[model samples]
Target: MIKAVFIDFYGTVVYEDGEVIQKVSQEIFVSGKVNDKSEIGSYWWNEFQTAFNNAYGDSFKAQRILEYKSLEKTIKHFKSSADAVKLSNLMFRHWIEPPIFEESKQFFELCPVPIYVLSNIDRADVLQAIKYHGLKPAGVFTSEDAKSYKPRKELFEFALNNVGLSAGEVLHIGDSLSSDIKGASSVGINAIWVNRNNREIPSGVTAVKNLIEIFDTKYFLHE
Candidate 1:
């Protein structure tokens, strides 16, 4: 029986920084240095992911710093004059104050088990956001706390150890397939994908459109 839930903070509980990222990408495209706005977005994400995957242990770096460096590299790669600091700051602001999903409030209010935040974001950013949105999870865990990011197992392990629960006794819910699903599965935790976009669900992966669906009779029941 599931004793608790581990939910992702950014995309699961609140909106991501996609809007600010799109704006930054558009700015780069308008500079005429990049051929397509989509390319800018793709390149930036690739750079950031690469950096994040390599960051761990003594080489660990904060998410905000990685974001800034990735943006800097993207600008240089496209020969764009966009101010990396300014663009990164814009992204950080959104990360700290992204709109909370309407359903999140409802789900939290009615959840049967204790919910803890398991996120790949910086500690301070997620903590500030939780406060800003008036969220009170049982606990909050971050990459910074573990000195490692998600999909790496270290962060998940760190969170599990602190929650004092066996992997089989916890369920993880998050939007990212690679990070949340894979990470939780690595540690033997069941995961439910919050596929808000109606994307194709892979074989053996249970998915829901939103948090409310988690309580469906087909999934799990309250108590």
Candidate 2:
């Protein structure tokens, strides 16, 4: 049986509003040749992951700084007349204040135990999202605190230790098959893949289409 529930913030709990980002990008990168302004937003996100993948603990950088740098590079490559710094600022601000998934909100409202956030994000950004969404988690922990990102065990251990629970006692739920499912399970915590995209689940991985599906599953209700 689960004693505590650990949720991931981005993609799992809320999504960065793509439409908003797309709209902002069009205003900034207004050009006759560019028919797909949304590519700017897409490139920004792709560069966001590229930045994270290139990040390191010994040479740590804040998420905001990385976002700005990555987006600036992306904008330059695309030859947009927009101010890369300004566009990056707008993108990061929109990211910090994201739309909370209604199903995630309802799940948080009804989860059986205290909920805490276990995310790969800057503390400030995650906290802001939590506050804006009124998530009111029992606690929030992140890579900025752990000095490492998930799929790495240190972050998970840090969260478990703070909550005073063994890995076996907590249930971790998130969207990534690699980071959320494998990461938690590797550390002995049971995990449910919040597969919002209906991706194919690998053998032995627990999955749900969304948080609402968790309430219907025996996994959440039973041991």
Candidate 3:
């Protein structure tokens, strides 16, 4: 039987703003267009990753700088950092509140097992999202708190340790194959992919587009 359930934040619990709703970005409102890491190259996406693999890694700070620069552009656009911060915070808040699924509230409230969060995000951001959405988690495990992102075994391991459980005792729900799926499975925690967009499940794991599917405790858990 499952003792606990770990859910991903973005994509699974909350959704990035789509065209239907206009959401603000605190970064954008307070600052501006974020730095063009692309100006550095497509490799810029991995800039943070590359730094991590090196001995003298300082990529988090570098990533923060990039964000700062991007926000700076917004400041130039709005002519005020305070306004940008307000707007951006509003947008950030939008992304977190209400969530992506009508079933989110039901499942969260009805889960038969303990529910927790395992996400690749800053600790403050995750807490803000949880508070805004009224998401009550038994525990929270974030990339910033773990000091490592998903696909890294330690990050998942950290959450498990915090909850005082083994991989077999919990089920992890997430969207990304590389991060959530692979990361949780690597440590023996069964992963259920929330492919809300109807994407094919990548080879190796089970997937369900709807959260309601996994709400059945008997499916993934040992009875």
lDDT of 3 by residue, 104-158 (tens): 8777887878899987665766778888878788888876666667777877888
Query: How badly does each model clash, as a count of residue pairs?
Result: 0, 0, 15
Q: Tens-digit lDDT track for model 1 on 165-216?
A: 9998889999999999988999899999999999999999999999998988
- Ordered by TM-score, highest first, the candidates read 1, 2, 3
Candidate 2 per-residue C-alpha lDDT over 58-116 given as tens digits, one digit per residue, 9 for 90 to 100 = 86677777877876776676776667666666766766798878787788888878999
Task: Indicate the TM-score of model 1.
Answer: 0.96
Which lDDT values do the candidates have, in the order given? Answer: 0.89, 0.79, 0.66
Q: Which ten residues in a row have the lowest lDDT in candidate 1?
A: 214-223
Pairs with backbone N, CA or C atoms under 3 Å apart (clashes), candidate 2: none
After superposing candidate 2, which stretches have Cα over 4 Å from the reference? 20-47
Residue 31 in candidate 3 has what lDDT? 42
Ranking by lDDT: 1, 2, 3
lDDT of 3 at 135: 74
- Would you estimate the TM-scores of all the predictions? 0.96, 0.84, 0.71
Best prediction by TM-score = 1
